[model samples]
Target chain A: MIRAIRSELLKVRTTSLWWLILIGVVAFTAVAIAFNMLATYVTIHPGTVGPQQGGPDSLLTSVTGLYTSGQYAGTLLAMVFGILIFTNEFFHQTATATFLATPKRTLVIGAKLIVAVIVGVVIALITTVLAVGSGLIFLSTQHADLYLGNAEVLKSIGLNWLAFAIWAVFGLGIGALLRSQILSVILGLVAMLIGQTVVQVVLALLSSYFHVKWLMKIAYYLPSSASSIMTSPHGADGFEWWAGALILLAYGAVAAVIGTVITRQRDIS
Target chain B: MADGQIVVTGLTKQFRKVRAVDNLSFTVQPGRVTGFLGPNGAGKTTTLRMLLGLVTATSGTATIGGRRYVDLPDPLRIVGAGLEASSFHKGRTGRDHLRVLCAAAGLPANRADHALEMVGLTPAAKRKVKGYSLGMKQRLGIAAGMLGDPQVLIFDEPANGLDPEGIRWMRTLLSSFADQGRTVLVSSHLLSEVQLFADDVVIIAAGKLIRQGPVEELTNLDGAARQIRVVTPEPDKLFGALELPRTAVAKDENGGFLVTGVTGPQIGKAALAAGVELHELAPQRADLEKVFLELTSGKAGIR
Candidate 1:
């Protein structure tokens, strides 16, 4: 097991894919920071825009929302990292050599899962720190409260990191299930970005017209909805923090099992 | 490292509708190079993959030191395999690529450099695999196979992209590896090259073992079928006069009589008895290439 982990880390360290990891860190954090700065500026200079939209309290939520919201951006990047960790082996035909070196296929999968979790947490932390730090700076410039020691704010940030970490594991499962790197990455991005949007849009239309209050109850268990509630607990009809975490955990667990079983049973040829 | 023999018994692999390997069995002993010879799509790669535990065999077993590859504790320290020259990430340097395997095999970090040096790839060790030429990639594959200095080694078409010099270098390397009492099984579709270095040959055709034995023994079996080519001024007279039992005389392309089922000296003695002048008498030796073609073309059955 130790040898497999060492080998997995070595493979990642030596590849040029590290550039992508760096790009993920900078891109996600920069985008979140820019949005927070723009929002904070608009809140301070209300007359500069057409009209003042929300009150200062709502503005404060949006300001800190950057820190928690950046989790999805980091999750996208971490998921890609996780997918590449396994897909690269298949793409390059290194799986043959890997299995030859360590014939226990499950051990290889396990070690890769460990690497994914580690990378996920690291990327999550880096993006979270940058987003929150930049958010604090922008809000302070407008003399708004930093909320540095607020338990709710701190918990949100911590859960945001945890969300990204779990998403990385989910990415590993997806990569294993779909061995094609391009196909898996595209499907992952679509499911994370467009798939969730489509679901939310359909659910809203259904509830608004049909007045099916019970249908919205099931949305809390969806992975994206669960993750959203985990990072921000103030949403309507959202599951509790523990329930949301369990929902995401369930997704990761199911994906990991399916991925591992398929990988083990399929011939490497 | 003590027991390095490889035994493959009734190994078979079927891919959905097609059978890639069909009850193929062979043994490779230590201290000698065995050439796994077959035409393209003849199941050589599939068999090697099963032996290395890359692909699961549908039936039978392949073992080294009386243990399956996966069953062996620390397989790389016992059996090293290069199933394909292209089995590597294109974005990593050769040295780093080897380091990954070394780390998996629990070998020292310096072994990567040593392996690179062994294959004469030290100069390009730091270059990414993408920029490597086909020959360089082949060399790198060999280096990776030898990384652990294992007792048993397997290579599939190791000489596929090598130049004449590179081929010679590989021949020497494989010979030396065998000389150290380590089992080596190198597969190739080229018969001439394998004949140059291999002590034993295992020939397969259409996913079935056709023939296997020492190189000399296989050639000697064909030696008895050797044809004698005789050049003479009078073709008609020589053809009728040299009447041999079960011997057929056919007109050659250049107007020489190709006498089969007879030796050179018998032809000479018969010529003297017939009082025919002989300009030239030469024995046509049967090489592995000819026998390989005959075997694969279904002209020769398994022996």
Candidate 2:
């Protein structure tokens, strides 16, 4: 198992995918920060205060505004990275060598999961730090009393960054289940963008006819819905942040097991 | 571990309705190059994959060094395999590819460089596999196979895209591995190539073992009739003189006599006794290619 992990790390380090993902994350985060900064500058210049009033709100006006956009971009970035991690093997025929070297399919899947989680956390942390730091600079220019060290602001930032890790695992699960980059990415996008809308519409229509509000509550525990809950300031009702994390972890576990089983049974040709 | 003995017993693999490998049983002994020969779609690759645990067999067992590949403590150190084309990531450098495999096999880091040099790819080791030619990629595959210096090596068409020189190098390398008391199993459709390197030949056809024996034993005529071609001034006299029951004489394309079912020495003695000047008396023994075709043909009941 250790050897498999070491080999997986070596592959991740040498491939160009890692660099491409890093550049992508940094670029998207920077653009998100710039857009938020521009919006804050326009709203706060000429000594005009925004509607929101508070140390956290005034200090993080730019960052708070960029959160929605940054989170979306981060999810997409993680999905691409995750898809490439598995699909690249199929595309390049590297999986044959990989399996032949290890032969224990579960070990390989475990190693991939470890690498994906680590990469996900690192990218998430970097993007959040850059966005927050840039937002603070813009706030300073406006002479707003924003406190970066405030408990609420720190909690939001830390939780939001941690959300990246969960989303990364979720993306890994999707990639494993689908096994193709294009298919996995399309499925991930539809699940992220339209799954919630469809579920909400169904929930609204069925709430009057049936007393099964638990169905919608369960939907909130899905990786996509739960991830939003983790990042949002006000957590969803009946679903705490820790519960959402557990749901995402469960999804990852199920995916890893299924992927390992299929891989072990199938031919590597 | 079985200590370099590959014992495959009743190994069977099926793909839906198709039986890719059926009840395949063979033992690849140590200290020899065991040639796995078959026609296209004859399940050679499938068998090799099952042996390496890359593909799970539907039933039976294929164990290397007396243990299933997945069960081996240090599999790569016990068995090394090079299957299919360029299994490395196209974007990764050859050096990094070998390094990753070395790490997986628990071999020392320096083995990667030594393997590259062994396959004569040390100079191109740093280049990405995407830029490598087919032959170079094959060389890198060979390098990867040798990384752990395993006791048993399995190669599937390792000389597929190689030039004559490369093929010679591969033949020598494989033979040397066997000479060092390692078991080498190579699968190829090219009978001529295997003729040069293989010490024992296991021929399969239609997912069944057709024949298995030493190359020379399969080709040599132990008791079978041998063809003796002869050119003589008088064809009729030569034909009448050679009145053997199995002997048949026909007119050659050059207006000479083509004699069959008689040895060269028998023909020469007959010609001398009949006062006929023998222009040519050439004995034709069956070659491996002929024997392989005959054995693999559908009429044979091996399948």
Candidate 3:
């Protein structure tokens, strides 16, 4: 198992995927922070700037919410990293060599899972630092009060890290279940970005038509909703903190089980 | 009883509506090179994959050293396989590709370099696989397979893109591997090449075993069935006189009388008795190429 893990790490290190993903982290975080800084600057110097639509409260909200909104981009990078871990093997036909070297397919999958989590944590931490550093510099320049040590700020950062970790593992599970590199990445991004939103909107419209609140409650239990609950500030009409965590955990558990079973019986060809 | 023996028993694989391999069975003994021959779509790759535990067999078993591949504690140390020459990530360097396998097998890192050197790929080890030609990729695959220095080695079309010199090098490497008491099973469509070094031959067609035996025995099984060509000025009289029971007689494109199922001495005697002046009389030896064509052509059922 240790050897397999080492092999997986070596594979990731030798490829260019890591550098591409890190670039994504820097670009996404920088853009989000830049937008927040622009908003803060506009709020403080209203005389020099044209008439603004919103007040400082809204500006502050977007500024502080960089940890949540900006993290979405960072976690997506982690998710891509996870997807490539298995898809690259399938696309390159290296899976044959991989399975031949270690006939126990489960060990290979396990090693990939381990690497995914480690990469997830490291990427999440790096992006968080970027957001925090940029937020500090920008907000301080605008003479705005930056709550660097606030409980809510810290909670949001920690949960965002957890979110990235879960998303990475989730990507691995999806990759294993669907071995196509293009399809897995596309479907995964769709589910994260649009599928859940479409579901919530359709459910809300249906609930309004039927005059039933329970129909809307079903959205709260979805994997996306659980993730939003953890990554978003406060709560959004879903399970409490621990319950949301458990639901997200359940997704990971199910994905892991199904993915492992499918891969074990699958032919490398 | 050899340590690297491979025993496949009644191995079968059905891919949905098509039976890719049908009750195929063959054994590869240590200290010998076994050539697995088959036509296109003949299930050679499928069978090798099954043996390596990459694909699940529908029925029967393929074992190396009396144990299934999945049951082996460290499979790479016991069995090394190059099932496809292009089974590599084009983005990775050749050295890193072998290094990954070495790590999995728990071998020293230098083994990757050593194997590359053995395959004459040490100079190109630092280059990415994407830049390699087909022959270079084949050498890299062989280097990866030999990284662990396993007791058993299996290759599927290992000479697909190799030049004649590279093919000869591969042949020498495989022979040396077998000479060291290791087992080597290679599948190829090149009959003449397999004839060069194969001690045992296992032939398959339509996913079924057609024939298998020592190379010499299979080629020289029935001397009477060997072909004989007689070029003579009196083609009609020679053809008529050469007629015999169980003999297939036909006129060659060059107006020569071709006879099968009769010894060259018998043809000579009949020609002398008939007073047919023969310009040239020669026996066509049954070689691996002829046997392969005959067996696969479905003309004569050798198995």
Q: What is the TM-score of chain B in candidate 2?
A: 0.91
Per-model interface RMSD values are 0.9, 1.1, 0.7
Question: How do the residues A52-111 of candidate 2 rate in per-residue lDDT, one tens digit apiece?
Answer: 444445535445555434766786687667667777787788888888788777788888
Across residues B175-238, which tens digit of lDDT does each residue of candidate 3 receive? 9999999999999978988898799999988789999999998888676447888788986686
Off by over 4 Å in 2: A39-69, A194-222, B221-225, B243-259, B299-303
Q: What is candidate 2's TM-score against the reference?
A: 0.91
- DockQ, Cα level, model 2: 0.75
Cα-based RMSD of the predictions, in order?
Answer: 2.6, 3.2, 3.0
Chain A, model 3: TM:
0.88
- Highest TM-score scorer: 1
Show where candidate 3 strays beyond 4 Å.
A40-63, A67-69, B243-247, B251-256, B274-276, B298-303
Model 2: lDDT equals 0.79
C-alpha lDDT of residue B118 in model 2: 95
Local error of candidate 1 at residue B68 (angstroms) = 0.7
**What is the TM-score of each predicted model, taking all chains together?**
0.94, 0.91, 0.92
